[model samples]
Target: MGAPLSAWPWENLGIFKYMLYGPFVGRVMYEIFYEEEKDWKFSWCLQLLILSAVRGLVYLFWNCYTNSLFLTRNRQILKQGVDFKQIDKEWDWDNFLILQTIFASMAYYMFPFLQNLPTWNSKGVIAALIFHVGISEPLYYWVHKKFHGDYLFTNYHSLHHSSPVPQSLTAGHGTVLEHMFLSLVIGIPILGASLMGYGSISMIYGYILIFDFLRSLGHCNVEFIPHNLFETFPFMRYIMYTPTYHTLHHTEKDCNFCLFMPLFDALGNTLSSKSWELHKSYSAGNDSRVPEFVFLAHIVDITSAMHGQCCLRTFASLPFRTRFFLIPFFPFAVIGVSAMWLWSKTFLFSFYYLRDRLHQTWVVPRCGFMYFLPFATEGINKHIEQAILTADKIGVKVISLAALNKNESLNGGGKLFVDKHPNLRVRVVHGNTLTAAVILDEIPKDATEVFLTGATSKLGRAIALYLCQKKVKVLMLTLSTERFEKVQKEAPLEYQSYLVQVTKYQAAQHCKTWIVGKWITPREQNWAPRGTHFHQFVVPPIFAFRRDCTYGDLAAMRLPKDVEGLGCCEYTMDRGVVHACHAGGIVHMLEGWTHHEVGAIDVDRIDVVWKAAMKHDLRPLSSGSTIKAN
Candidate 1:
């Protein structure tokens, strides 16, 4: 059986018609207005000069923003070895700086003679601008292949190609020869159109500079295109020239010739089918396929710095926005200032409440954390020892079984004392069978504090579940906002609400959280079975007893330290969960946690707090342990 005929072929055929017929139609109109100007020398020069200078400025500023994002997100923000060192070196032989100046200056000198031409009418003027963008870009595209030929690429184009990760600055990166050749691409058609009376000097050259910014933007390394902008429309999606389109050009060196649209490349069939596929998938390039950058948890730190700066200014006798003109911008100003308030309310409270009891600056590492094994680091050997030491003032003696060597540091250590305090011996147990037998042998018959810690991994989650199965009031601590959200949605109503109220202070700092119990309400059965992504959730109560829950959530000592808050209740967002709307949400449960069949919370629905509360019909989870604060 043969493959079905493809629609892409038909689509290419239509583009071919547009490309071939477009310039011919343009040239026909040019012949109608052909006229000789008495003096053309100075005007042509002046127009070209202004065009280049203005475009260069726009390109420079845009490049700055795009470059900063690429470098910062990639952790190249601080600059690295050999490649970075080479950046400061000047290789201005390829500098387009002189070329832009030369062109803009020449245009200024030539405008007088070029401007008074009889063909400089508004219609012809617009056509001249149209012709500059319309033809020069296609010409560059059609000829870029030959430019990348062995001879030209090695000396002329290779300099620009050096920025495989091209920034906006890289847009103008070409050898002196390439810079010279670029002018011809615009000038030849432009001058010919002028000789044929197409349009005037001013509009034609002005459009050329605009094309510069377009190409510069097209070459930006960052993926700034909002997917929603183009995806909803069928025709526009394919037509838009994405950063991917230009990036693919740098990679293969064969397909990037056309820049304006697929009009040239699609019709010519020179565009990479692979590029198109990636564009459709929205991956852009493999380099851009990075883990998410979490600005939510980070916002608190940035805001703190900004607020401090503002306060300092005020203390020094300067108001933030005292000028009259700044009044109208107050709404935007308020939003800018309110970043702290928004983060604290929305993410701070929820996420920190889920991550930990300490308000620390938490960083979510890229790549899965599954590969890390439990081990020693930074003076903490047995995790239980550390927990014991932390609670030692109260006469607690803890032992850890983490020495069995299956778990990693943070993952193991956090789990051993999660929501629990140490008073007895803890032994490290590895392998599923060994851990089960050990648990069967010695259960904490009179454990005073029962809590769960560790990652949502097979080993860690299992340990927590085992504690939960013993009817131990487990303290569940999730690392990512995504995990916290999943657990909250999956847990029974009481557990869910208790998590919120208990962790509010912790959630306030880092947008990550740590809640300390699992009491399956009827609400859990309803929400959990529906699959744990999102559901209508009520805000958990603020007080978990007579104590302010925020104060209690922060009372834990060993949590990661926050950028601000000086070691108070802190949390860190798992960068992995920045945009649930965009990111893949597969939950990574602790290795041992899933296997035990500890049973899930039972709930079919939750209409209100009282309905779920009535279903709970038991003392609040924290009521048993919480003593009235002094």
Candidate 2:
């Protein structure tokens, strides 16, 4: 009977009320000290410090909570897969705390110098905020530009740039000099306003809280700003900055230098080129429940001899449509070919689920072989389109065109696919970039001359151009002299001296390094010299047996490891290698790069592939002395 059930002990003591109105505790203390006739300046100073400390504590807790919420809420869009509980070794929290304390003390020391104590009223508070923002933007921009100078950047500013993936806590994580500069940038505006008699103690504390919140928001990895808000009010984008804008400053390093507002960046022309597109695309909160998955689609022709023969024998009794329907039931037929009638068709063969440790997700690579031959351009195009449609049904993120697929779909280097298949979310890549990279990297440094077959083809043309740039003597072999001369005329003026167009295979024998650009028959392999290093770039790789001869493939050299189903010629040194085109799809999946990487290879992309391979500890499978087909 001491207390009713509705009136709890904690409520009767007013603990809940005190907690709810904790910020007003400073006001209560100020009033109590005023009654005692304490020194007004000392009492005001104590109240200001208390209020500032309370706001700072509240912001810190709010930052932690909001960051956790955003990370959990938009896990898929952020896609960092980082554990917030695990502190990074690079974060110097001890130094951060010490520097913050020093800045706080400095701000407190400077407080007495200001003539006007800040007014606690709403109008004064609003006026002070406007002044603070107006002054801080330009001051921060110039100081930031100075910090980016060579001397300061190398010694101090580079510490902040170390975080490629930033978080809320990283907002102030930098060297002592950097932190001092940043604190000055935040502090000067408030001090200037107070000196002008526009700011009050409450205004100073309020501005600091808002400043910290905005800075924290900029550093947060999650893009929380609604894109439609900017669309509705275009000027709002100038007034506010998104997380992507700040992230671009870290990744690109040359743009988006403003602190809170993008006004300075727009004036300086320092905004990122892709900032608006990224903001619009990524700002919509992501589905957190969707588990990350990568898909790779490959094509294998059903017209190939090994698979075609088996397919014909198996489907001898079945009708055309019957064979098509039964194709999925027969695993061997699916892997190889269906029938001669369906040779113009493409079918998805094998599917792989590999754990990509880098992305912390499952990467699925599917092999879909087209039934059309290399030279069958019209038929190959029809099958390629069908293969893409089938891949779309499976919901593959990316489909890599291999060999003949590349040859048919080389219109603007797969840009045609992108234009034609807008509804299909799957991205098409030629996978030729890394193929060229592997070929270039493997060529013997001292070799003066290299033989390039099918020089008019896209891959061959790219290689020919790259080799010409390197000043290596290139023997360009093509079936048609007209096509050869056309390519020669198109070659750069400087490259003319190094390039030699040849019609015969005998001309290639003189060159020690042979690049097989087209599918070589058994007779064609014997044309190269005994000691020649044949770098095969074609699928279903062809090999020559000669005394002390070396055989390697462009695809084999770039593979992180020897995959079981990869097409390798019957040779010891280059066994267990997959097609370069197939490897390209796997590379895209493992790295989780969702873009069109088509046409001529980018040399930079090879470095990316090499780094990913090393990070994942991927290695070539054991190569036996004798080759065995999978």
Top of the candidates by lDDT: 2
Ten-residue segment with the worst summed lDDT in candidate 1? 581-590
Model 1 per-residue lDDT tens digits across residues 81-104: 112212322122114544544554
lDDT (Cα, 0-100) at 562 in candidate 2: 26
What does candidate 1 score on TM?
0.38
- lDDT score, candidate 2, position 230: 91
- lDDT for residue 375 in candidate 2, whole number 0-100: 56
Q: Residue 387 in model 2: shift from native, Å?
A: 35
Candidate 2 off by > 4 Å: 1-78, 83-86, 90-119, 286-630
Candidate 2 local accuracy as lDDT? Answer: 0.57
